[model samples]
Target: MRKAMPAALVTALAVHLLAGCAENRTAGAGTDTTGAEIPEKVSAGTVIAVGSPETKVALQLSGQIDELPFKVKWVQMSGGPQCSEAFRAGELDVCSAAEVPSIHARWTGLPTKLVAAEFRKDPHRNPIYELGIAPGADIDTLEDLRGKKIAYSPGQAQGALVLRILARAGLTEKDVELVELPSTGDVYPTALGSRQVDAAPLGGVNIKRFTTKYGKEGGKTIKHGLRDDPAHLWVPTESVNDPQKAAAIREFVKFWARAQVWIDEHPKEWVEGYYVKDQGLSREDGEYLVRINGTSDIPADWDPVVERHQKTVDLLAEKTGNEPFDAETLFDRRYETVAADAVADGRKGS
Candidate 1:
């Protein structure tokens, strides 16, 4: 109306506005730290981090955690991709996710470092990852999965497990159709129940619910028997460079190890609070998961763990047809001493 702006300038302005809006929209929703002031020291300002629901349980069960040296603002993310996004946006200082995601992050040249590794004491019997088939699907074994549509979330733990399972079966990604989906609570169930996917990888509470709802008659689960893929805690490179934030992370790692001991010691309480009340799973299912899938053991040493991760790197490289990077280089060993002390403290507390 009044001397309209040039179209090019107008479009550029609109693009800028939209990007700003998008950033603002995603800032603190669901598990993020949007508006919090960045602190020079861990004690002076809030440290925003991402973790699984279990992180909440650990914090809650670990009494005296409120007395932490730094203030932590935890955002609960379902899987690694979300955590990676938060890290990319500079919204998260630290995150907890499975091994593959951290490796993927490093592979993509993200400024992140693996601080600690969490292993299951009895991974085979209490495996945290599994692949499940639909109720009426004709798939019985891994070989039968060829050409079938499998629900997959790439770069997460499940995706890595699927690749391993396929490799064990002498198959490749070309052997099956991957139905890409976000690794969320309900996506797996819905995909399987509706027959949208022939098979899917599941973990944590979803595993309990799926098995209970489908049982043996309705559906079946395939255990991969691969336990080298451990979970990890990753931090932004900047945070590691910050003395205060690094110190806080060290303390947090010790607390997390002790929290696992608490969870193992008090399974019933954990089930009641985390599984039943928080996740809406039945008490029976909660108890089964807690007892069967024991808490993770935080290992301070990186050599053995790095060796295990190298295998994973090779697998990913083979599958994706990309050159493998050294897994050892991705790790930041500054926290090893602190983590070892934490493990000892956790044992003493237990």
Candidate 2:
């Protein structure tokens, strides 16, 4: 478990990051405690602490970061769990993550909402993960998951994917051993390679690397054959309630939406800029990533998105014995069309 950050230290970090912002504020730049309305324009003094490395890379590579209306202090956050910790510490305003973070936050009583949601154009064809079978494991299919020791991270997408896979296989938690583990960095692949768990979900370049290193030892990967692509820009509800931060978040979402389109339209540049240059992956590996991820899909209507989220919540609740609340509460409908509109406008940095 990670240790809690000291409050004073968090405050100092926030202040230091925001110290260079313009002193003069735009009209209607004050804080809004009533939650009645969000400011339409971002204030000059507004500085949003964002924790999305992928978006940062996209903006920087495409020169969109130079055109932002407000200041951004980029925070180094790895995944949903880290983002939640930063949100709890009042150090992060917004983050890009999977669907599990918002569900996990709400389950843990942290007030957060999904400001924007996205998915792959063909989710099954471009799944974010594949089940990695251990070197000596006898598993060959989803049904073979029974009686196996599976790696699980309760508040993460991989963990949820495991549950969904088991459900598809018509199995329950009692049917297999769920070894608790953190799926950060090379942990999952390392655990699978060591035979600590029979099967674990691996994503991005880890999928290819795992198979190559361990294929000689009988390691293999199986397609989960499930829709595991859920991309989101989420935030603590407090940020949306504040007028200045809310305005900045709104603009950020527009840019974020356009960035997805930009990446799809310019795959070669994306591979060169993001996967190879920024991430230090080989050109072949980067090309594999681009092929697997396919294209972006930002829906104009959130009703279907809400339905899918509810199903995820229900499955998670059933597997973990948590209460199943309405998933619609996890979304801020005010910005439902923001991303779609931005994509439609075909603007680089709106």
Candidate 3:
């Protein structure tokens, strides 16, 4: 099992990184904690953490990252449910998840908080998931496929959200046949070409390209039923909102914001370096992937980008008869203060 960072280790990381910032602030900016020119070092700090993939890349690229007040750590998790589990076990500091998982994670008493959003606009989104119908299958829309076999996720995290699409399309679980597919991977290819199930919403790129391979191109798409919208976020909860936790959260956001900017500016590089090399994606496919889903970039702080995520959660909860947790409480806007500070730090350095 992955372990929580030890206090001594956290102390060491914090000091090493904070000392750099202290020195920078001293010789570079000539300022104190409040700009009073105390010239004293930041006393102590700890390791701040978040989920894998985006956060890990962000932290790695963060300039003077180790110079932050804490050692930043990131962990890769399977899905929202698993992340929620780790958080409950006190194994996680900050997590990235879809709006549904955030609500359900909070519902299960995870004491988590949502800080910033990871925006995904269609036409440039990744994995290109879609609800595909079998080759030449009669299914076209959610309503038409009533009584036709369909797959649902085990929990309300990834798969359950699909039901929201169905309900929005004037269909319910009872209206159509319901089947529980093992996972998204299994469900997608099955819906695309097999007779195992009728349809399932999958990431769009594959559906856009591969559906033609199956002679089903130009058919009804997954979005014909579900609207495209903002999806995930980087969240830290009440449990980790202490002064130390707050420091880490701030650094995570500041660095993450910078990383998004970098990715946005240098999508080609990221596709080659991170996605192609690190992820083992073929160069040709890598370029295709980058060209398509390579553009979810947004500013660091929570803005309209994050608000859309909030509305998505509320809408899903209303559809599933689940509770919509308090937006102000879960998605704390106070992180905006930390982001604002980060921007100032950037300007001062420039």
Candidate 4:
């Protein structure tokens, strides 16, 4: 019989084989990239650069920031579009966003993976967005969307939500005047107030601020009546490929999962720390946001989540004319149970 290989050599061979297998896996139908391996443990000097300000605030407020296994260099950034730019530059490792970013990234040929997912406990009651009707637009129902000029952003969650809303209302892009606009800052509300677009999805503090500023002029918002509550923590594939960084990312996901619970358990602190002090919102505005966001729900099973993502991908493809690929490819299932398990363990300890 041939002599057995050394333990170290055997371990090295296994890792090499695993990496080769990962390289053979499809990134997507039209993409030319593949995912990376998940390291078993964080190494010394591991640092995970992050661009999610809300998570940073949550960790800082809850003292979880000090509990991390590795160093995290916080980057002052937010939104999927911005995060994608940083990811492209190789300056950011992880970012938080809604579902559209990953879809858009894959379409744009960027190799990214969603590592964690979260949703509202009651998304229907606490939607992240509502359709804001322009002053004197006379659009009372989703059916009224017909013949209206709608603000659209193809690369953002609002754009995807607009498509979903139209589908729910039994309408199509052909039914409305799609005015492509950047849905950032006060753009949607500003567009509505100035009558540049008859309708746009407004979220967070903008919902109330829009009406408060233009209610006298007949500006109002209506429920979109759909699930627009996909919150995720995603990373560049290259970051996850590095052994140390991958291990650190795994630990970060655990903290992120627990952070959601901390937010739900300590709503007052979250509103104060994240919204008021960190975001510069007034106490009342912060409270309004907390109430609208409701509670966090991190599911143990991602089958249903992946299924919903498929629908989102299908919808985006239907509108954007991009080649539809498997949405499950966008998710790294290695992390499917990481967040849920972390939350469960936290609950047990408490």
- For every model shown, what is its TM-score relative to the native structure? 0.82, 0.89, 0.72, 0.89
Give Cα-based local distance difference scores for all models: 0.71, 0.84, 0.55, 0.84
Identify the runs in model 3 with alpha carbons over 4 angstroms from their true place.
Answer: 1-45, 58-69, 121-128, 154-157, 182-187, 190-192, 204-222, 225-231, 236-239, 297-315, 337-350
Residues 1-350 of candidate 4: C-alpha lDDT, one tens digit per residue: 12223323442453454443234332322342335457777776787899888788888888988989889999998778789778776789999888998987776667788889999988899999999999999999999999888988877899889888898899998888878777999999999999988999999999999999999999999998998999899888777666687788889999999888999899899878888888899999989988888999998899999999999988777676667889988887878899999999999999
Best by lDDT: 2
lDDT of 2 at 164: 88
Candidate 2 wrongly placed segments (more than 4 Å): 1-35, 347-350
lDDT tens digits, residues 194-258, model 2?
99899999999899999999999999999999999988998888788787898899999998988
lDDT of 3: 0.55
Residue-level error in angstroms, candidate 4, position 294: 0.5
The sequence of per-residue lDDT tens digits that candidate 1 reaches over residues 1-350 is: 02223323442453454455345433422332212333434665646465656766767766646767768877766356777767767778777777887766655545567877778887888888778888888888888989888886666777778888888888877788777776676898778877888899887677767877887657768777777448777876666665667767777776766667678778888888888888788898888788777766667667888898899889877765456888876677766655667768667755
Q: What is the lDDT of residue 26 in candidate 2?
A: 12
Report the Cα lDDT for candidate 4.
0.84
When 1 and 2 are scored with TM-score, the better candidate is 2
